[model samples]
Target: MGGFVRANEPEKVISLFEELKEKLGGGMIYDGTPYGNLMKAYFMKGMEEEAMVCYSEVLGEGSKVRFGAVSYNSVLDALGRHEKLDDAIKLFDRMIKEHDPPRRIAVNLGSFNVMVDAYCIAGRFNDAIKVFGEMGERKCTPDTLSYNNLIDQLGKNQLVGQAEELYKEMGERGINPDEYTYILLAEACFGVDRVDDAVGYFKKMVDLGLRPNANAYNKVIGGLVDVGRLDEAQGFFDQMPEKEVKPNVASYELLLKAYVEAGRLDDAIKTAEGILLDESVAFSDEMKELLEGALRKVGREEDIAKMYEDVEREKAERAARAAEEKARAEALAREEEERKKAEAAAKEAAAARASQAAIEAVLGRRKEAAKEESPDGGSNADDGGILKRLGITNGPVEEKRAENGNVVGASVGDESVKQDGEAKEGAGSGGAADQATAL
Candidate 1:
């Protein structure tokens, strides 16, 4: 059944499930596993109606299945994935409500987390806060992930103070804030124009022995760059490599943009050269255009031209390589086609030879049978006559009669023929013609 789900064959899953239910009998008590599987399949197939039907059937009072937390979490996750946050919230509410012993599905931390994230995504911060509060009311302690979701969402929605308060609350609860917590708090402070607070959180992150990744550094650098804090941003940028965190393309781009905006053409050019030095960094067309525009604004046409020339060279080289590859591919395809044609031609020639050999064999056998049937063992004279008619051999020469019914021979060139009945044995004066008659 898991295989069917992984293979994305929802119809097969449904059919197999029906067969299982039939074999197990209608009175069989099902756990959350089967219902979760059904809900997952329906969700994957985007069959909301079918998924709801499955959920309804599982939650039905007469149904023998006792749906658990896993079942409720699975359905909630499905609803979240489909962007049905409203329905997810409703389901979450029902999960928290008291139910009979057999039908009760306790709402877990994962359940609250899903609802909070969904509400945040839908821009309903108040609803998200309400759900977060309910977690406390239900005695479900929020974990790091839960807090992270709310803090990040609150930051994005410009509620940085609230998010900061939550951060303090985490410390008060004896929760050790992880790297993500610090990153989010920093981002929240930055979002609300609290640059110093943002930097403080970043420093706090380092003090906590947490390594700030490229994304975290980029956010801090970008935030500083956003508010004309180029010196501080550059300071952070320079510290990245020292901290063993490599500056990414985004980091370079942000710094370069800040330099260009500050009319620091030399600095921008130097930064671009640095980016070029790092082969790992890909200089995108957008970045290229940005740099070009900056150079143009500063009246650095020579540098602009040089940059365009380099870009053109790179483009030409890439085109040349692509053309070379295409040529090689075409050559290979032609070779393969020619090879097949040659093989076919060889096969046809062999077939033709075999056919000819068979015909010749049949003719030879017919001749041998004819020879055996002949009474005189096939006389040589008859064989010779047949050979002569077929132009296979020379036969006896016949005499040619003249107009007077007498035997005649070749006449000498430019000489009158002998009119007498006597034959001349001597060679004629025309030696060439006499030699021809001698034959």
Candidate 2:
């Protein structure tokens, strides 16, 4: 039957049990090993209704079959797992209260744990505590494991205060809290915003010389991260090494994820480096891929080849590449700026030359006209013609003059002014052609 159960051949076990019953026709089998196996087979085959009926007939009032604590705990677990809480409680009551030989201790510590677990499933946490309290009346004094089991269920449901009461009770009862006990208490504390309580439990565990595993450290660190106590989270991570507890991938991953999300890439990279340094941890591809997928967005992902290489060398290479890229970009920018300035200066010079050429051409034509007009080597009123072509008005307005001995301003447009080729050529500089026509 055990073989059949291990093979998951529940129907075959049941059929064999039925055949054995038939062979023994009018006799009652009071031994519970076979009956318990039958119930397990029923459960294994998902025959919950049949299993429940079988449990009642075998263990109910006036029944000859006597199931010990092992069988009772098994069925209780099944009931708890399947959410058959009410039935589980009723069976638990019978186990504790069964008085054939008046042996209440027939229900072992497992019986109490199972009931606590069942109550936890139903969210009847106070009832779970009550179940533990009733253990004394049942003549079963729970050891550290029993307390740990009950506290584990309470912690799972975030019943921090109740779990703490249990922890307090353990100390009072002289049962030393183990590593798992402290770990569960710490998690429960964190679950209920009691950060100080959580940290204290960790300290308590250490003070008692209990070596916490990577998982224990991770739970405390993760709780600290959850409540935005990032500094404390980082502190715990750092303390792991000091305590001789090596941080695993999960330990680093918790802080890495927190750092990256908080826009702290440097911190994330630092945590990632810690993972690479720990050779004991298999840096599986899934974990590596997860980290890279997250870090890739910020362009801070570790180089896979460099992950296994010399750390300092990898850092140096990355810094060199970044500096080289920066310098190249700056150089390109400076070249672009220089090119633009040179183009602007060259255009200005071209415009100045064009303007000068236009002025020279007009002056040359007037110079020829002046030569032809004054062929007798005397002055004519050619000044007016030259001035008219130059776009200066022929006016008697004395802008500047010297009357006898009195002084005045320079005559900028005095019609009486006379000049030969040199004067006209000199005056051509201040021409009416503005820079607009230069190009």
Candidate 3:
């Protein structure tokens, strides 16, 4: 049955239950219990008529099956939950009529609590109070939950004094206020600008050994934020965890807004960063996105520019490193090329020296033989003497002379051509002089 409910196939189960009830011979079984369960399901499914009919049928079964207090509360709770208060009251009256032992049959606090809650929700605070009064008259003393519910409802309705008076009444009745009780009264006081009063109740909550929940802290923080006491609000926020209470999204948002309103933009930004980065602080996607938008709206342009500057600096550093690496590689390649060139040049110089030495030795021997053949031959004298002095001569002398003559003649011709050079120089000078004279 739990599986059926979780699986959202209640109708299938309802049909099966109906078949089982029909086959089992109705009076032998407690069919009334399932009706209440089905009522809850039908209401959840928005099948109000079916739920009410199920209730009516159970009531018709009378004392044969004990419909019990849960059954009565179920119908009441369902009708009230659906906002069918009038129907809920009618069913409550019917339950009163169906008491087996008549006068001895008692309605418990649970049933009364449901009706009280219903009246409170319906804004019949006077009627709700009257019902609570009657419960006392009937010796159904209001419990802690009863007072808490009433106080919460009154606070929500903005009846701060009324909530306080009820708290006083509960205290007079010897019902020691719990954490929820104080939280409710504080909320009421906060709503009505009674910050001092709210703070008093919060102190009482602490004294009573009741750990304030997030809502409790939020109510107080919200009050502080509203009064523009941001520093005090911050103090309270800082105290939350020490009290075993954690700030929820509402608490954080109230503080953030306080910081913003106080013109403490840095504080606001830090608070937002904590929310975003703190591992222990869980935030919803909606809240995260909302804070991001708020930060962008309030963030300074200089701050953004600084952030971009840091990013650009990092990028420039990376680029410089990459350029240095490229330069180093180029230098390495150039060094390798230079080393290869130096080695090749050294080898070429060594080979040239060896070839020159062999040519000089061969020319020396040839000159000696020529000089012996004709002692007066000026050819051997000039060739051997020049070769011996200069250290060269292995190729043809005529070729050498032609090569040397081309060199010598070009040099001598250049010296001999000085007159023409002087004539051109003088003519050029004369033209300049003539042009100058003309000008």
Q: What is candidate 2's local distance difference test score?
A: 0.76
lDDT, candidate 3, residue 435? 94
Against the correct fold, how does model 3 do in TM-score?
A: 0.58
Provide the lDDT at 281 for model 3: 70
- Residues 88-140, candidate 1: write the lDDT tens digits: 87777677775334555477778788787788777888888888877877667
Candidate 1 residue-wise lDDT at 208: 79
What tens digits encode model 2's per-residue C-alpha lDDT throughout 1-439? 7688779899998998988888889376776767656777888778878988987887778898867777777767767766688888787777766633444335777888878887888888888888889888767788999899888888877777788898899989898889999999988888888899899999899999999998999999999999878889999889988999888878888887787678676676567777765667665676566666766776654654455466667667878999999999999999999999999999999999998799768856775777676766523345445656777563432322224322232233553444332355454544535444775
**In candidate 3, what are the lDDT values of residues 84-197, reduced to their tens digit?**
889878877766566444454536677788888888888888888887777765556889998888888889999777788888998788988888888888878888888888
lDDT of 3 at 292: 49
Listed per model in order, the count of residue pairs whose N, CA or C atoms clash below 3 Å is 0, 0, 0
User: Each prediction's Cα lDDT score?
Assistant: 0.76, 0.76, 0.71
Model 3 weakest 10-residue run by lDDT: 404-413
Which segments of candidate 3 are over 4 A away from where they belong?
1-31, 61-65, 94-106, 261-263, 283-439
Better of 1 and 2 by TM-score: 2
